[model samples]
Target: MAAKTDRSDININRSMPPGKIIPELVYDDLDQAVVWLCQAFGFKERLHFRNHRCQLVLGEASFIAKANPTLTESSNNNRLQPQPNQMDHSVLVRIEDVDQHFEQAVKSGASVISPPKDYPYGERQYSVEDIGGHIWTFSQSIADVDLSEWSGVLSDNPEDAF
Candidate 1:
């Protein structure tokens, strides 16, 4: 679930909505990644189906997770087909408990790139990688620092002394 939500006027029905992310990953074994994500990161399974070619699918989308292949602009295969992207960008997920979540992911075989750290923007977050090599950065807002008091923020007061 999204913790620090930006001010919004749109009325949403559900507690959460599907995340919008597009990433390409290389995986000969897709099923393994799906199962591990559900168990490790709490992403629920949404739907499973077959494409036009009748290939079995494991598309699971929820408020937290969306599993699908990312389309690439180029392909080197002799068949001249567009292949799913193997190298991709990291997806950052903001959560409530950075320490607990990071521990759980580590227990579930995720390699940690960095531990939780407090950022100036008021968040304590950590990062991990799934088996398929996709980086998932889970973050949480821990400190609510007043940027107005900082030396460089845009505000009437340039420093706390004011």
Candidate 2:
């Protein structure tokens, strides 16, 4: 029998990974990508799915790393590719120390896109490109600034706000 979560009525499967939204990132080399991501970003491996995919977690956030299928395997199947010259999307992770995370990523040979910078919105963040070209932004909250202070509008209903 499936269990239920207090946060919501959704059924919780202990055998499956957790996270409201888990990004399944495609990489040319699954093993290398997993190692690099763990070493560079402090992600811990939560589950391994043979040689094709794996689940990784950083704090409360989790994402899947999948091997990009070959042309033969992609035939008549959904085609997934690694990030090309132009990125389709980027992953953002909130951590305790953006500076420490940035330094670790740099030491692990991650390509830096932007160094740590403080924003008026009360976050210190840094961006980097992984070995497979995926962009990841690490952020740390430095303050609890109101949304209006950063030109963000608050929802009329307090319940609508995250």
Candidate 3:
């Protein structure tokens, strides 16, 4: 089809949240989730909807923490639920220092899945499970490694790679 046009010049509604893609994580306890995420993950609370949802931000990134819907409150098609014991997905965040972030998360009682380790892809990263059982990965780029060096395939469209 056709290439997408840039929309940066267009004015966005002020009521809408920022970020091209914002993830909404469901939690059983909205208040506790907000507090734990702030303390452990260093996310600052941006906006809170009483007892329902809250927007969070770290640097220029943003996401939302929403309350899990009760069975009676939602239909199966639209119901939201907290993370189950088995992880189906994880959120990855780029930070300035992976080591420092891991330490702070550990100190704040995050359950460590993997400690910080450097990868051939030129990043230092770690994984942890939050209070709501959601997995989060924090990473820091340590070098600008060539994709070929790590056996990574480059996209034909260079703009799609980033």
Best by lDDT: 2
lDDT of 2 by residue, 1-162 (tens): 677887675689865678778898888889999999999999999989877789999989999998876633534546567554678889999999999999999999999999999999999999999998888999999999989899988667979654
TM-score for each of the candidates: 0.57, 0.91, 0.86
* lDDT, candidate 3, at 34: 96
As for candidate 1, its clashing pairs are: 26-86
Q: Rank candidates by TM-score, best first.
A: 2, 3, 1
Per-residue lDDT of candidate 1, residues 59-115 (tens digit): 323323323333322434332222334435677766768888878788898877888
Candidate 2 TM-score, true structure as reference: 0.91
Off by over 4 Å in 3: 1-11, 71-85, 160-162
User: lDDT scores for all predictions?
Assistant: 0.57, 0.87, 0.85
**Which regions in candidate 1 have their CA more than 4 angstroms from the true location?**
1-26, 51-88, 148-162
Q: Write the per-residue lDDT of candidate 3 for residues 38-126, one digit (tens) a residue.
A: 99999999999767789999997889998876622542446556454678788999999898899999999999999999999999999
| lDDT for predicted candidate 3 compared with the true structure | 0.85
Candidate 2 segments exceeding 4 Å error: 71-78
For candidate 3, the 10 contiguous residues with the lowest summed lDDT are: 1-10
